[model samples]
Target chain A: MWVALSYACWGISIVLALWMLYDWFKIDTTYSEEMLTSSREGELEAVSEKHRI
Target chain B: MTIAAEPAVQVQGDRVSLLRVLGPAHVWALGVGIVLVGEFTGWNFAADKGGALAALIVCWIVGLLYTSVAMIDSEVTSTVAAAGGQYAQAKHIVGPLMAFNVALFLVFAYTMLEVSDAILLGDTIVAKAGVEGLNHNSFIAATIVVLAWLNYRGVLMTLNVNFVITAIAYVSIVILFLSVSPWTQGAVLKLNELVTPGNALPYGWIGVIAAFQFGIWYYLGIEGTTQAAEEVRSPARSLPYGTMAGMITLLIAAAMTWYVCASLMPWEYLGITYYPLWDAGKLTGSALLENLLFIATLLAALASANGCINDAARAWFSLGRDRYLPTWFSAVHPKYRTPYRSILFLLPIALAFAFIADLNQAITFSILSGVLQYTFMSINIIMFRKKWPLGSIRRGYTHPFHPLPAIVLFCLCVVTFFAIFLGFGSQLIAMVAFYFLISLWFHFYRYKFVRRGAQFTMPWPKPQGY
Candidate 1:
């Protein structure tokens, strides 16, 4: 019975963590800029040329 | 029109085409898939008796530190984005030999883990079906065959399958938890007991440290998602979020599960053989619910295997592309557009390990290799910070205190390296010796045969501002 209960709590915890992360992403739009520079001039062109399909 | 000769290697190129393969959803699925595997295996139990609370805290801290590293990886991949992610990054940052060593350790680690997951999948399936005297080797072989087929189909197909499997895994875990929780009689919820060391370790700061070391395994493949950075759409945005989200979700779920298990059941009853969650389901409900939980375990094992295989193939593909291994290993299927040769090579190694070894030995080898990889990654990040300085790419998610967490993680890794020796005795020594021998072979082959008397060049261009 305890084992079942514990698993339930664990499940709830996962849901909550996912929720928090979602909110964190929503609040900071600029967070993506540091990791990605696609909008910058010459960068996208360079990437396209390098990885031509 | 002038006739042009077709290149012998159609897929052999400087960069991978992101349009043909991966996207944000695939990236998210891969990250979550890796985390689900860690959680499904009763890895939380490994952290249980050894100061569970301390381990939990350290896991969160480590998650933050890894976030920084993930961002770094994202930045690096953007600049030199290729199919061979880590090997390319390592070669660019350090040198060819160092990159080769890192890639070698990763291949050994990931291959061992894939085999271990396959064996566990067989165990889960057999036990759930109430089948006795099942041919374990045959089951392992079959599982590897199925996994290899999935790999052969290509990344998009693999990702789709992974998405479905992960969804089922998440839903089942939720159902298992909800169904069992209502029946608990007197489950005492005490957080204090987690800190008090008992059978797992002696009571001291070292015990706390030891607990953290074991707990790190639960978060082992968190950074693996970064290997797919180049494939993701706008990786600068998706990579950090996906990696951190996956890890944070895993952390919370693991702690909650640990607490529930520790509080609800007596320590003696929750033995190593019986899965605590499944046992709880049996106690609370009918045979049907028990069967459901059993099926859930099977699905979890299968998903975990899939995730491990994907990561392992990518790592080796990167190595082959960097010319650290035989060039043939870099072959991608013409139609499928996946790392076919690398996947084929990995299967035999994984299958052999699965058939010959028991779960404990396989896990030990995997964990040891993982430790080496993590240590090297942490050191590389520090080196980049020092040497690159102003030229180092900006991080989307930075560790709160510059270098402190990195230092702490490094120290934890060093202690864990020693702990493996102490904890596992002769096995640890044998593995380390084997690793050194492999490293020695690479050194000789590269220096004596390939680049004789040439000065060793670091993988990446030296930063101008350093």
Candidate 2:
């Protein structure tokens, strides 16, 4: 029973990992390099905003 | 196309960045969480080499090493304000070649540490439960997976969890210290154990030098807090306070751990025992302390693994973003605003190390890689100050007694390499050769992919000496 639970955990991780890879491919195919690396969001936020508590 | 100097407000819809949501508290959590595991185990090997007193002295000596590390890192990281921490600093201060090596060091250091933590977490659970046929790999995979998912979702949630678990593990050490009642004049401790001449320095002064390598286990990953620079809301304010606070916390915790364990047990036994805190707790004959120490051990591994996942992914992400590696790994999650691909990509590599690499080898690699970074940091800071003098560019937090700390850190790193050689001579030589081969690959093949001008992201003026 304990062995089964451990395998179950691995199974969940495999599924999650696959989902991430799928998302990765989808985004890669959808966006151009110009759009993807155009500007860093943190730099933009740094200019005018501070995180509110 | 060049990255614009002006803030690109219009690109927010298409090109996302990591969320700038972390505060100093989270920064403290990230640094302390990665290091608190050392307080649980791996440090007592020093006691085995030199003796309890020697281990304590080496611990302070290593504390100085990491203090210099934290000081240099805080000053640079605050000004750089990038995700890759030392790698980013290398790119701006040094050049692409050094940056490539720093990235490799960051990735391997955290990834291997993560692997060690996961394996330990799995083994600890199985050992504690008295399970006969449980697969340790399954628990290891799950620990990595869940933490990666949390990291993939967002930095805030990942570090928030780190804060809670790291705090619990830290408090457990304090509980053990108080329960022993060290202030009550040897209530539960065998004070005589400390003064036994044979027990204090059995192997002589040579043993003290040998003990220096394991002393690194006391504060291995505290400098990792700087990896969160880009995500932090206020780098200038947060990095210095968080990094220094984390250092002070580790110093106290390390001393407390040594005091409690060294006072309760003879150095000969304490040196060879795995999980010295747990053993010390058992010596008190209190089931409550023993069980709590067990739980604390488990939590420390979990916390360290979580922070490792966070740090390793960020370094990989920064590398990708700058085209140091393939650009495909650079994408941020559109909605989650996290480096989802980088997090998932490092998952398999960490798992591979966890299963195939010997735990001791993995840890040695991690320590050696960290020492390489510290050695370079001393050089990096001196260059930083020389190229960009005090008033040349603004600094978030400047370390005092300029050049002294850098000199001390460099000297300590050289000493540590000798200590490592005295014990694991072959591993030391192999690590140097491995890095050498990879540096060649980056120079010969990978440099073409990187955009040289765009790589210097900081808006500072041309360097002074340049």
Candidate 3:
């Protein structure tokens, strides 16, 4: 049981990491640097300094 | 009228921001969760350096050091309000060079700690299963990846999970303390264990000094609450309250853990063992207590690893955002609004350290990084007050007894460094050389990339001295 669980953990982690890599590249290609770095929500929040839902 | 300046960075695309959903409770969980794991394991090394009584004494002394750290961190973090915590403070108060080094310190400190936590969890599992020489790599990788995934998803869910697991571990310590019933005549605790000859101070006063480095285990990383400064719903209020509350909880927890363990086992045994709390539970001969402690140890490791992911990623992301590393690292997840790239990037680094498998070596590296950061903190706050004196800007919280805390903090950091030298001298020199080299790299290559104009995010008046 323990060995199987360990193997399962290893399998799950590799899958998750691969998924993250795929998403990371996809996002990089899709968004412009200006769009990516400029934070719309952060600007509004920084100015007001108020909590938002 | 208040100054209404343009956004710190200009852009031509849709907006993305980290969720501002955290409150005081989440802040407490973030800080305590990262640190409570120490109570279960690494802290007993202090007994090895001195003795049981010496460990207790050093615990209080180190407690005072962290109290100073919390107070100073709260004041600056409350006003600066950024993700990198001390890195952001260093940028505004000192300069880019100092900020770069501080950011690196925060990254390494958390990452090494995460590695140690994962290794401990893996070893515990193998031991419990009665297995011999099983490879722990898979479990270590699994632990980092899982926590990194959670952090990538969102901060709220990540910290909420931490809060639950951290609370359980804390309550277990309290239960163990009560079960020992030190106040009762037929108590399980052996008060004589403390005063038994060499147990009090075997190596004498110098030993007490030597114990200072490990004493930090009792309350390391409590200042990490400030790393959540950006995500907090109200930094001004939540940062100070959450940080102080976490400090108080750690002091109480540290005292009780020492009392329970020091009383149950001989000083020599307690000093050398990695599973002091669990061993104490076994001594009680209560099957329930032993199992509770076993589970608590596991959960505490998980909680610590989880918080380390959140903090290390934040500091690294903040550096990327400032162009100190690469702007590629700065991108926030469009949907999750988390620093997804930074989280994923650190996964491999954490795994590499975990594979090293020397828990003591890993912890020493983490502690030294932390000590350097704390030393810089004392300097940063002194400069902060000098540059922007009282009434210069709207400080969210102001630390009392200004130079006193800073002075004491600086002095304590010096003593801790000596303690580290006595134990891990070569490692100390290696870390210093490492930072020194990085500082050079930043001054030459990296500084060219940093957008200096945009570095100052706060809209405060001109600094008085600068």
- Candidate topping TM-score: 3
lDDT per residue (tens digit) for residues B1-466 in model 3: 1112313332224656666778898999999999999999988999999988889998999999999999999999999988989999999999999999999999999999999899988877776777655677788888889899889878888988999999999999999998888686336887684557755999998999999999999988898999998888889999999999999999999999998898888888989888888888999999999989988988999999999999999999988888899877777876677888899899988998798758998899999999999999999999998888888888889999999999999999999999999999998999999999989999998799777668887888878855
Would candidate 3 be rated incorrect, acceptable, medium or high by CAPRI criteria? acceptable
Ordered from best to worst lDDT, the candidate numbers read 3, 2, 1
Mark the regions of model 2 whose C-alpha exceeds 4 Å error after superposition. Answer: A1-8, A18-53, B1-11
Best by DockQ: 3
Interface RMSD of each: 16.9, 4.8, 4.8
Error of 2 at B129 (Å): 2.0
Model 1 scores a C-alpha lDDT of: 0.58
**Candidate 2 on B1-466: residue-level lDDT in tens?**
1111322232354556666778898999999999998888778889987899888999999999999999999898888888889999999999998988998899988998998888877877777668777768888888888888888877878888899999999999999999888886467887674648756888898888888888998999998998998878789989999999999999999999998898888888888776788888899999999999999998999999999999999899888888889887787776566777789899989988898876667778888889899999999999999989888889999999889999999999998988898888898899889989988998999888888787887889999867
DockQ (0 to 1) for model 2: 0.41
Cα lDDT for residue B377, model 1?
69
| Docking class of predicted structure 2 | acceptable
> Model 1 captures what fraction of native contacts?
0.01
Q: Tell me the tens digit of each residue's lDDT in model 1 across B160-199.
A: 7777777777666666556545345344343345334453
Error of 3 at A6 (Å): 1.4
Q: What TM value does the first chain of each candidate achieve?
A: 0.51, 0.69, 0.74
Query: Candidate 1 or 3, higher TM-score?
Result: 3
lDDT-wise, the better of 1 and 3 is 3
